[model samples]
Target: MTALGLLYPGHSAEDDYPRIEQLLGSDIRVDVVHTDIGEDAHRVDALKEMGSPERLAAGVEQLRLTGAESVVWACTSGSFVYGWEGAHDQVRALARTAGMPASSTSFAFVHAAAELGVRRVAVGATYPDDVADLFASFLGAGGVEVVSVRGSGVITAAEVGEWTEEDVLTLARQADTPTAEALLLPDTALHTAALIPTLEKELSKPVLTANQVTVWEALRLTDRRVNAPALGALFTREPIVQV
Candidate 1:
């Protein structure tokens, strides 16, 4: 079995892994090491705060020892909130520590969309409106256009995690734009992995969730090119070479 390591904040992996497993089809072993975001609120800000390089690096190091071939920082807000350069630096730093490939959920979203040949995308997030724009800008830098954006304005990882499936589905519907080729629910705190199939069916376009791309990118770094039927159009599309 191919092993992939995911470094995420505290949440229920039992709920998240099934969606990923459905995509990789039981051949991939996903090892998730959750860090405590609730305890160290001082070191990181919610979607808007700069992620601590020291803490992030340490977390990647810990996840690396979990027998993972590659590692991914599975927090979208925590990664891209640092801006493009900062996000790149963080990934490089984590890769250096792990002595393996590393990526962030934020970068994964854009790369996944690009892989699908999507140019315009709508934004759906559980963050405040202003904070959501930070994500938009990050994606825009990667050659994707942001059409419309909607946010729930919620703060704190715990609160975001506690949101129901209905909350995310509603937000995704509201954020859809006519010009959008895809919709991005870009927050690792908000679990949209299981909802990707539903979202794509409703929108009739690819709906790239945070964890979806995070996992996809991490898997791409390995030799495993998984075809996940349950992951929606993002995974259903052909494999794309990273530019």
Candidate 2:
């Protein structure tokens, strides 16, 4: 089995990893280790602290015990709040600490978009508009165009985790645009593991969620792919050929 480690921040939506593991069958294993959350606010300072090297290192120690081949920081706002370059550095540090391939959900969205040949996307963010704007900018750095972004102005991960399936669908509908090739729900705190197929069907397009892309990113690092259509378009594709 290919084991993927997720260094999650706090209590929201970490359960999505296990749901993904079950969906992908026994060939893959997902292990989540919650890192220090410090303050659960979505502000830049709080997020930066959340993804700090010290906290990630601590989480890596736990993942090492799980025999995880790859590690991913499973928080979108926590990584993107560091901006594109800083996020790269963050994962680099994580890789060094884990002694494995490492990435973050922010980069996961970018890579997932490219995997599906989607250049333009609309964002359905649970962060405030200002924080969500940072995500758009980070995507821009990764060569994905943000056609539009709609933020829910939610302040904490706890609140986002409590959002129901209908709430997620509503956000997707609100963020989608005619010009966008796909829609992105960029909040790992939000529960979306069960809503991916529904969201894609309702929008009639690809809907990439934070947790979904996080698992995909871990698999990408391991050069593995699974046939799980229920996980939506990203998982339906074949393994990516890395040059």
Winning candidate number (TM-score): 2
Error of 1 at 95 (Å): 0.4
Q: Pick by lDDT: which candidate is best?
A: 2
RMSD for each model, in Å, please?
2.6, 1.5
RMSD of 2: 1.5
lDDT of each: 0.78, 0.92
- Worst 10-residue lDDT window for candidate 1 reads 40-49
For residues 181-211, could you state the per-residue lDDT of candidate 2 as single tens digits?
A: 9999999999999999999899989899999
Candidate 1 per-residue lDDT over residues 1-243, each given as its tens digit: 778888886673325765686668767878887765545231235433335566566577667677799988888888877889889988898888888988888889877887888889999887777778888998988888998888777766667777788988889889998899999988777777778888888898888887788888888879667777688887777856667
Q: What is the Cα-based TM-score of model 2?
A: 0.97
